[model samples]
Target: MENQTKVTEFILVGFPSHPGSQLLLSVLSSTMYAVTVIGNACMIFIIRTDSKLHTPMYFFLENLSILDICYSSVITPKAALTFSLGKRIISYNDCASQMFFFSLFGTTEAFFLAVMAYDRFTAVCNPLLYKIIMNKRLCVFMVVGSYLSGCINCTIQTGFTFSLSFCGSKEINHFFCDVPAVMYTSCSDTLVNEIVMLALCGSIIVGTALVVFISYGYIIITIVRMPSAESRLKAFSTCSSHMLSVCLFFGTVFFMYAQPGATSSPNKSKAISILYTIVIPMLNPFIYTLRNKEVKESLKKKFKKKGVFFVPLLRMRMTTVSN
Candidate 1:
């Protein structure tokens, strides 16, 4: 199909063309985007300034929070702009770049969550050995490792996706430059590309999900076997947030990637996209930090010392709910 005419650009029809609904969605997403940035930024600031928050858990927490910021920034702004301007055309190179960073941040977030799961396993399984296992050097290595994995996967996926020649309809039915959605616009046979996608993206999703599930599974067992009710409850509470976050992140990811080019309606894909790209990032800080008492206390103390009069997006909501 080398002789087939190729598409140099794709027009994204992000949301439905209904004026009222488009207006409502743009407003809602803009508000969510603002909240996502503020929440994640607050966590980053709190983790950075607080000496008490300088542990491995909080260190990973900081990385996660920042990832949320970057992750949301990737798709939300462009999405909002697309809705507002009513111009959703993206150049091939620009689309490739957007998909690259989106995948990069997204994959990094998944691995980071897995790393956090491992950290929790250490904290719960061997509290004493946690220090030894999760030291500064190891933490640094983990962060670096996650970033590297993300970059490699992003490069592979983006390279392959962009290499495919687009010979069919130039209209992309989704809000953002998702790999599968873009692949559907290609007139070239994407059999090899599809296999590469399964090997790289599919493996990451399945492998990471397995690791996280196993980690939490072991954690639940350990928590149940604990002698003290208080200890068990606290451990369970801590794991709940991470577990919920994992489900939200991976559920949408699996749904989108597992079925490549299955967009019956662009609106449905936009709705699904909201779960992982927008909503999950906005919720991650709340899951990882706001639910933890230590993080709250640190934030409160820092706010008091700085005399900062910022509205509490999320106050210390540390309830001792049993697992």
Candidate 2:
């Protein structure tokens, strides 16, 4: 970590890498990583190509898919490779780079979720001014602001992390170069580091969460006042995906990072890490798209344009009609 540090590399000793489990873990991790990448990539592509999805909500969603792709990539490929690498060793520089990118994308994503909530609020509570308030320029600015905030967050955390002195070779028990796992290996006293970690993780996770809560509150009130049940259902449907996404994402993240000095067994920590890092990324696309009719329609249109699904069905129906 520092000039006094003897360790030039760290071993990722997260999951059991025994022969039998190694094959299974490698295959499973690789599969999940592939799915996560493809899913998020498709999400971004769909949002980009679909004129119907060019609104602020999907615009923010496009950023989210990008973030999901990035952060998951920061960890997943290395992790899957770990099963095959004889020593599962990662050099100091690589580890640090992983940590920085992971933190940057992860933090930016939390802020973006809050941004999405605010977008939802404005669109729901003040439909008339939604266009004016959430114009493209402001949307781009907010996205850039979130990215800058993430850069600042990760730079500070990564700087403080690798600055500590390590007396010997280290094994990072968790899958990735997560802050806590790296900090845990430092021989130097990390009280300040721990406090700093807690503060930053809390503010990012909880702070964005607070924004989501307030925005949703106002959104709910507005929805409750709507005269038509159909409108109410439509509004609720629009929000349901975001709500589920927020819960699935933030719940595991808060438990994992928000506790600064808390101790957990490596297995438990690994399980939680897998949930947020791998599983959630794979799930988010489905979570967001399954409940959104517009995205579904767009996807169907894409398939139809490609002559994949709907067009074939249309041909079968026309054939029946000819008979």
Candidate 3:
């Protein structure tokens, strides 16, 4: 404990070696970070501004966009700075804060995804009672519940992590202060930490994933029983985008955290982390918009109303002609 107090900061050894590679990575990371912020911001703006999108689905989507923005911001900017400006040191308190927020947002995202799955189930599986089931009060509760659960979970995880005495080197092998990487530096026995991680974190990740899968299973059954092909297609389209996002998020997360630590190569883990932390957020807006005709139409109407339509159309035409 005394030695732990002596340590004031930790060196974040982000993306190990190759200065040239780091520069390239910085450029790419910065570009993705900008896209993530802008794309999610647009989603939020469109959902809020569009009266037609006031349904439960879009409401949950707006929340998801907000989460994506927050979750990515917690890690990406600092990582981009590390790659670009070579600032690799993080204060002990700052590191703990980062871990707490990261875990909070991450856990919230998982629960929110589960709630979104429930929303979809209500919408598709019980269309007649969708409004009654997912009323404003319930929606608000779900969102608030996600945040509260995140706060509780992160508090425990962060407290448990920081309570352990860290000795030897303070070098974290990843771009950000993830639990596994942080624990690796501790001189104290981490069996309890690992067990807690397996029990608490695993329950959150796996439990939410099961909810999503079970919801989708019922959704598929309901969609198949629809009277018309058009209805079936509409139902599938609505859920497909969400399902893809879920798969991308849960797949990468489960890969990183579900297994025992230090078994996978650090570089591989870093690459996976990049996918979930940066690429997924940036891609989510595109995935939801490109696949959903309603969002695209809403966007077109918004842009045309604002007299910004011509620019996007002109760019599209230029790209088409070039191709």
Candidate 4:
């Protein structure tokens, strides 16, 4: 205890160092944040308004988009503000809260993505059972399960991190209060926490990755075995976007968490984190909308209707004014 350093808060040094970087970082991050919200919102709205997207695939996609929005919101804006103000101080309690939510959302995403893979598998491999297998109740339950897993993971990770005493210098090496980064600052023994992290977080990442791989593996086989060329092509197309999203989201995740601390680079982690948090979400809507003919047609119909409805109203107003 004598040598223990009491830390009230921790400083988060975010992004590369540069003069007036705060202003630049703030503007850039703010734009990204805005786009994330709008993009995800549009996705949710399109999925909702467009009856054609009323399938299990789109249902899960809507939830995934929403999660990405929140996942980005939890850390990006705060980090941006810190960069903008050139202040990186985060209180102990706030830091723990951030870590908790971040872990929760992230863990939930892993499970959700796994669920999506399974959905794709059923849609491809068991076309007849797709309806029964992915019913409304089942979809709702899956979403709930993802949230529950996230909550439990958050509780465990946050509880573990907070239990340790932080009687030391509070300068965190990373932009966020990631579990490993926080653990490094603790004066108390963190072996248990680290082990839990490796076991729980690692398992979630690896387990989800395994599920996705297996599902896609089976799907590819099923697609190839199909007698009709058209059916095979359509099936592959349907799942291609989901597969791409999965690879991007979880690939960086596994790469970041799977590595040992000795070899992990702060710069690498930050860059990969940016990919998942900023770039991936921005890319999803484009992937789905562009690849899926139904989504494109739906958008066209929605806009066309708006244009037709508004044009008549404008004409009526002009005629009444002239009379």
Candidate 5:
């Protein structure tokens, strides 16, 4: 026990050296990390300052941006700097902290995405009662519930994960300390840990996914029943951005954690993990901004109010002609 505890750090494996892959990973990781922070931060700023965006939809979006800022900050900073360090080492406790926050924010984002979907349903299918149903108190409650759920999941999984003896290879076969990657280093039995992780993570992913799908199912039905073509188009447009965000995030996350205990190549795992951990955060601002007329309008209003070069902005702003 003393010797195991004395082992304080683990080596993180970078990509195999193949024609500048390491440099590429570093550059790509750094770029994405920067974009994720700036983009999400700007989104939060936009949402906060825009009174027009204080509604439930933008409220949920603000929370989602906050989550994006969080989970990515925990993981991306280290991953971005991996190649710069000669040793590529991380302390044992730090690894556990990283895993804990990553899981917490990731799980919270999952639940919150489901909540966003339901918000959309209420907006589209029950517009008259939307405000009354999705009141401020309820929004706060759902947001708190998602965070509390994530806290519980993180505490349980992180505790179970680090409890196992990790006296084997201190080398983790990935750029960061992920659950599956860290589990690979444990010398003691991880079967139960793996089972717990799978059960909890799978439940969160699958269960929240069902909520999103079911909500969208009703949304689709409602849209279909609408008489006018323009109304149907507008209604579908309202949900499109959320659906895209959902597909990108849930697909990558499901691929990563849904099959815990299953053996796969470290490189394969790392490649897929990048999509959610790195790529999604960077894309989210664009996803919610470019096609979103309201966000663009808000940006226009903001820029116009600040008197920050409005002519070029006016030219670019017309591109998002849809809702």
Candidate 6:
């Protein structure tokens, strides 16, 4: 490894070939990034200001929105740049930093989703004790604990990855500094690195997925036992949005990282990455708000308060007077 020169920088081969496709993709990527930021920001703002949404469920949702924004930012900007400017050169330190934050926010998102599932479980299976169990302190503790755990995981993974001697190829065949992509460029043995990555990341992904599955299992049983159709429907409605979110997030993640070996093409991986990083963040706000009755009501009340609903009516009356 010492015989080969150490790589100080990496050139990312982001979406190679097809100039027309790249241009279109750039436009789409930029649009998605804007939507992701604004949508998540609106969710956070709405939840914070709406007193009615001050429950453990919304609290965790707000945390998830924030995480979506953060995790998307770590990957989307570089991807967008690749499309727009075709500038894919990244410094070694910058690559490491990107990987660190990506891991941190990504891991945090996984845990937060698990916590949200638990919140839903409590709300459905034990409604009477939901407020008592998911108190403010516990909520704060869960959020803080997720971040702390992410930091520790990121530290271990990033330290091990960068410690290797990267000698041969500095050109990564992906948009951003993904762990596997970077590892592929190393001249030194990546057996331990790959093993460690699989162990840590697999645990986080599989563990959270199991928790969500179990929570939903209990929720399903509880809903089925309800005597009335209305009661079951109402209970299921509360969980539908969360279930969609969990499926979208975890499905793409598992496909991208949790596979036994790399069977898919790099282009397929990139497409999946775009789905999880760009599309999912933008979709979260719409999914929760459009599907949620409380959120819709809150939005209507907010718009009504600001005279958004009445402005058109007033304008019509003024036009009639002028005529």
Best by lDDT: 3
User: Candidate 1, residues 1-323: lDDT per residue as tens digits?
Assistant: 36233556789878666887777878888999998999999889888988888899889888998889989998998888888778789987889889999999999988998999999999998898989989999999999999999999999988887777777678887888988788777777788877788778788888888889898888999999999999998998778888889999889888777555543445676688988988888888778675787887887787686564433322333332321
Task: Identify the runs in model 3 with alpha carbons over 4 angstroms from their true place.
Answer: 262-265, 308-323
lDDT of 4 by residue, 159-194 (tens): 888788877667777778887777776778887877
| Predicted candidate 2 versus true structure: per-residue lDDT over 51-116, tens digit per residue | 888899999999899889888889888887877664578898999999999999989989998999
Clashing pairs in 1: 167-187
TM-score of each: 0.90, 0.92, 0.93, 0.91, 0.92, 0.93
RMSD of 5: 6.0
Local distance difference test, per candidate?
A: 0.84, 0.87, 0.90, 0.84, 0.87, 0.87
C-alpha root-mean-square deviation, each candidate: 7.5, 3.7, 4.8, 2.4, 6.0, 2.4
Task: Show model 6 residue runs off by greater than 4 Å.
Answer: 1-5, 262-265, 308-323
Question: Which parts of model 1 have CA positions greater than 4 angstroms off?
Answer: 1-6, 259-267, 306-323
Q: Distance (Å) between predicted and true CA of 268, model 2? A: 2.2
lDDT tens digits, residue span 1-323, model 5: 66568679999986657546767777888888889889999999999988888999999999999899898899887886786544479998899999899989999999999999999999999999999999999999999999999999989988887887877688988888888888877888788877888888899999999999999999999999999999998888778999999999999888888775442557788888888988998999999998688899998888777676776676677865542
Report how far off residue 169 is in candidate 3 (Å).
0.5
* Per-candidate clash tally: 1, 0, 0, 2, 0, 0
Superposed Cα RMSD, model 6 = 2.4
Runs with alpha carbons beyond 4 Å of true place in candidate 2: 1-5, 85-87, 263-265, 308-323
